[model samples]
Target: MMKRPFGIAVAQLGPIQPSDSRASAVARLVEMMREAASLGARMVVFPELALTTFFPRYWMSDEDAIERYFEKSMPSAQTQILFDTSKNLGIGFYLGYAELTTDGHRFNTSILVDQTGKIVGRYRKIHLPGHADHKVGKPFQHLEKKYFEVGNEGFHVWQTMDARIGMCLCNDRRWTETWRVLALQGADIVAVGYNTPSVNIHWPEPPHLRMHSHLISLQAAAYQNTTWIAAAGKAGLEDGCHLFAGSVIVSPAGEILAQTQSEDDEVIYCKADLALADTFRQHIFNYGAHRRPEHYRLITERTGVGDPLGKEPDPS
Candidate 1:
């Protein structure tokens, strides 16, 4: 059986400040959808924490302010317009955001919606970074751990139009567990969105090739997993803070098929053959045929509640 090829857009966005309302931020998303839809892209990938600036840095003494940034649910009154636009345009998308769960846990998350404007799946970022407290003496900004709890759920995959779609966010990509979990589950494409700040005060100023290295990480993960990948970014200096912007679409062979420029805002468009993805999966990089899960039994495992895979393993 032959599968049809599809195209996706990595609509790398510029920075949105704390003042940018959901209505306004979503308006920008809508424009990308319309443009991508016109270009025949079945799906579009937006940046991590796309609805607002990366606000986890500032600790809110007043908790009510959390409601303003975190979406109670997808397509809240402020976001309904973007959902409506997707329905009217007939394209699917994966949107990243800060989510407040009913249990009072905050998560870094993303959702997958099909062309008909229905949410098919959801994934939360597993890697929680930065220190919890805002230490005045500790170099730069610190507070994500203070604001958002570490996501307990792991990676996930969804069946869509004969392609296995998967989602992971910024820090999640730095870890191999997220990609491996999805790869084992038969994901054909992995979508990642990030807002990587330029100030790595901990280290010397990184050279320009770092963006290329970032793409390599995504590409290598795709190759090792035999999956196509679309990684988008929130680029440019947002209110004086600069972020690295190098959105990319990579083939399963770890090749850069399409990529955005190194600065400001841009989008990368690439046609991906779902069948070719299978070719890679079946050939050299076949994940299932070659992976050895039993060997990892050396690592002691424990059980825990609320585990995504089942009540089975303790998150080490």
Candidate 2:
């Protein structure tokens, strides 16, 4: 089944210092969006919290965090230009940001906009990582749990711009269930945005493994779910903290079609064969033919590892 190829891009952002204004950050994004359009990309994926610095690294009161980092509305005065650009260029986009709702709820969120600049779907980050309490001895804090609430809405896929697209943020990409839930809904492409520090604050993890693990996780998810994945990262140093950059566009076969070479603002484009996913999904990942939901009760029933569910079948 041959389908029209779709052009997609990942726009990797450089550091956004604590002092940088939202206007400055959005200008950078507009530049990249135009560049992606020039490259024939119909859609561009931006990094997590692209409008501001990764603020969870600092320990601040909820009031200060909301006032400084979270956006009360998606297309506020500072961000309206992104939507305008999308409409002018006739391109779609996925953007991640810190969201503050009218009901006083905070969430790490992302929105999917179609080519006409209409928001088609919204996804809040489900897998919030890190600790709620501040660690006194650590160099920097990862206080995501303290700042944002766990997303209430579950995973979803929306049909727009001639494709079925899904959205996830940062830590969600590392979990298998994230991809599975989106795949089960027939997502042809998954757009992920992240802000991952080069060093692990909780453990003495080798820095190189950060990039390696990032790539491997995307590759594994793409192949297993038979979906194309576009992941963008806010890279470079921000207020002395380093975030690694390896923004990539991966194919359904788990092959990296394009990757950014620098830890700065960059754009990588790929002409993706939407039907490529069908080749694998129709055979290797034929869920209806191979899945066994009855035997996987442990996945939903338990949160922690314990004794085996039942003894192995007796040989006698």
Residues 163-250, candidate 2, lDDT per residue (tens digit)? Answer: 9999999999999999999999989999999999999987789999989999999999999999999999999999999999999999
lDDT of each: 0.79, 0.95
Q: What TM-score number comes out for model 1?
A: 0.89
Candidate 1 wrongly placed segments (more than 4 Å): 1-3, 62-65, 137-142, 205-212, 298-316
Which tens-of-lDDT digit does each residue in 1-316 have in candidate 1?
4865888888888888778787778888888888888888889999998989877656565285476677777768888877787788888898999888877778888888888888898887777777665557433464667767777766789998457999999878776667878888888888999888766644565746666567778987988887889998998877677778888998888888988876655667887887777887788866567767788643334223434433545424
Residue 205 in model 1: lDDT:
59
Q: Ten consecutive residues with minimal summed lDDT in candidate 2?
A: 307-316
Candidate 2 Cα lDDT to native:
0.95
TM-scores for all candidates: the values are: 0.89, 0.96
